[model samples]
Target: MVTKEVRLQSTVAGLTADGRVHTLSVWFILALRLMMGLAFFQSGLDKVLSGEFGAGGYLTGAVPDSGSPAADLFVAMGNTPWFVDFVNVAVPWGELLIGLGLLFGAFTRLAAFWGAFMMLLFYLGNWDVAHGYINGDFAYMLVFLSVAAFGAGRILGLDTYIEGYEIDGQPLVERYPWTRYILG
Candidate 1:
């Protein structure tokens, strides 16, 4: 029942209204995203280039040689041979994928989730060695987790579009009780 002219006017009004809240500084967002993405991407690339495919083998003898805490665990796990080999193939590639996703802002939220997850595992691994206490491991993990929690991509990545579309068409996911706290 709406006329074309009326629809056009409403569209313009909606865009103007949305523009107010979409005033996130583009340069700042790009810088944050680029820096974070580059850090992840480079790490992933290094893992592959260094032949640390799964990061398992690297964890094993690589640590004990440096007198690391998980020496026993790594040595024991490395003895598995098969498991270490599997990790060598899978983990490094996973890092590469995660890095690429973040660097390109392809799936910012998902990349952040994976990056945070990786940080969690790394932190746990370090904790197992350190036996708990103030350590940089946990702190780094928290930082990545914080990014995921806030949906950092919303600042300048594809997440902005994703959020906008969702905000416009379907508010269901955003309305979830825990989504706000998690996705911020």
Candidate 2:
């Protein structure tokens, strides 16, 4: 057997960083995608089936009580009648769609982007400085980003097929480079 390594490099603020990842780590990447997918799917399914998922109380009461820095924004959103209605529909449906995308590895990057965004919001809303700023929600957000960055969908995922589909005798990614943002 041969060991495989993936070299990664990045530059930010004139600082360069580089690292190598073991190919065997792919399993963990896939695991992260599946775990989040299942968790979000189950949570969304329950919310949809129960038809009792309302963000108003939590956004206004819980967020404010939690002393989150963004409490005012959340309360504002909760107070807006139209926004609340939108949230009533968006939260469950968004979670369901995001979960499905991640589970099947279709539109994986797009799904992960939304998942990260949601996690960021969750982190802010559930803020607790008692144990430092980092929390599960923040960690989950990073995981979603990692999934996107690693293109986890390309491993035994529909995105692989989708990206390879032919268009004008060219691969999808080659034909539509912008799709890279959402695919993979």
Candidate 3:
């Protein structure tokens, strides 16, 4: 746990149990969470809303014609019609849901996980874009992973309240590693 101190001009002063004032860069965190959520949500929404999604056009083009290095790998994964069709339909909507959840600080951790998973798929699908270290897909994946790990939603949104009452000091959270990963 981390603690911050806020000093008021008035004489009234209080300390958290950790002996520090409660303070955090809530604005900065909110900005980061919103941007991250929006980016992921938009990507997913674009995929689902567009007819291109589930059309298999991009997946097919992911081959040599698409110049994606991971074309062969994707081809292998796409062998299943279900997988191919699911990506087309599911990815975009999933992203949109994730974005909405993150935006509102609802189930933030789950959203982050889904976002990270989507990013992983993107990285795998667009390996051709991995031109050296600046692979945008990879970077996005990392960001999502970080969000999942850090519980970004609790920064300035409803998740903080959820954690304090519904989840705070719970045995499940204290004992289970995955519990903390959830938005609470």
Candidate 4:
């Protein structure tokens, strides 16, 4: 087997960093995508099937009790009847759609973006700094971001075909450059 090396470089705040990635890293990236997809899909499916996933109590009670910095905001959202209603529907449906997108590698970046956002909220809402600042939610959020940055969808994913689809003698991505944000 041939070994391929991918060189990565980035500079932030006058600091430079670089690394080399082996081709074998692709499998791990794919695994992260599939793992998140399955976990979110199952969680959403259970919530949908049970028809009893309410965020109000946790937002108002648990968040405050956990001493999260965003407790006030969470409580405010919980107190709002309309917002609670919206959350009820949004949480399950959003997870379902996001999971589907990741699972099929369709609109993967979009899905990962939302997934990361959800994980951020979970990180804040759950608010457990007992051991340290880092937790599963934080780790999951980073994973989602990594998946998007790596364009994991291109690896045996529908995004590859979708991006290459012809449109007016040009590929879809070529026709609409903005698609790069969401397609991969």
* Deviation in Å, model 2, residue 12 alpha carbon: 1.3
Q: In order, how many clashes per candidate?
A: 3, 0, 4, 0
TM-score of 4: 0.96
TM-score of each: 0.57, 0.96, 0.70, 0.96
Those runs of model 1 whose alpha carbons end farther than 4 Å from true positions after fitting are: 1-33, 49-57, 62-76, 124-132, 163-184
Candidate number that wins on lDDT, 1 or 3 = 3
* Candidate 3 lDDT tens digits, 77-128: 5676887777767777888888988888878888888877877767766665
lDDT string, candidate 2, 1-184, tens digits: 8776678999999999999887778899999999998888988898899999999999999999999999999999999999999999989988998899999998999999999999999999998889999899999999999999989898778999999999989999999999999988
Q: Which regions of candidate 4 fall more than 4 Å away from where they truly are?
A: 1-4
Query: How many residue-pair clashes does candidate 3 contain?
Result: 4
Show the colliding residue pairs in model 1: 53-88, 54-87, 54-88
Question: Which ten-residue region of model 1 has the weakest summed lDDT?
Answer: 2-11
Predicted candidate 4 versus true structure: per-residue lDDT over 80-130, tens digit per residue = 999999999999989988888888888999999999999999999999999
> Poorest 10 consecutive residues of model 3 by lDDT?
15-24
Q: In candidate 3, which residue ranges exceed 4 Å CA deviation?
A: 1-26, 63-69, 129-131, 165-178
In Å, residue 182's CA in model 1 sits off its true spot by 10
RMSD of each: 11.2, 1.1, 8.8, 1.1
Q: Of 1 and 4, which scores higher on lDDT?
A: 4
C-alpha RMSD (angstroms) for model 3: 8.8
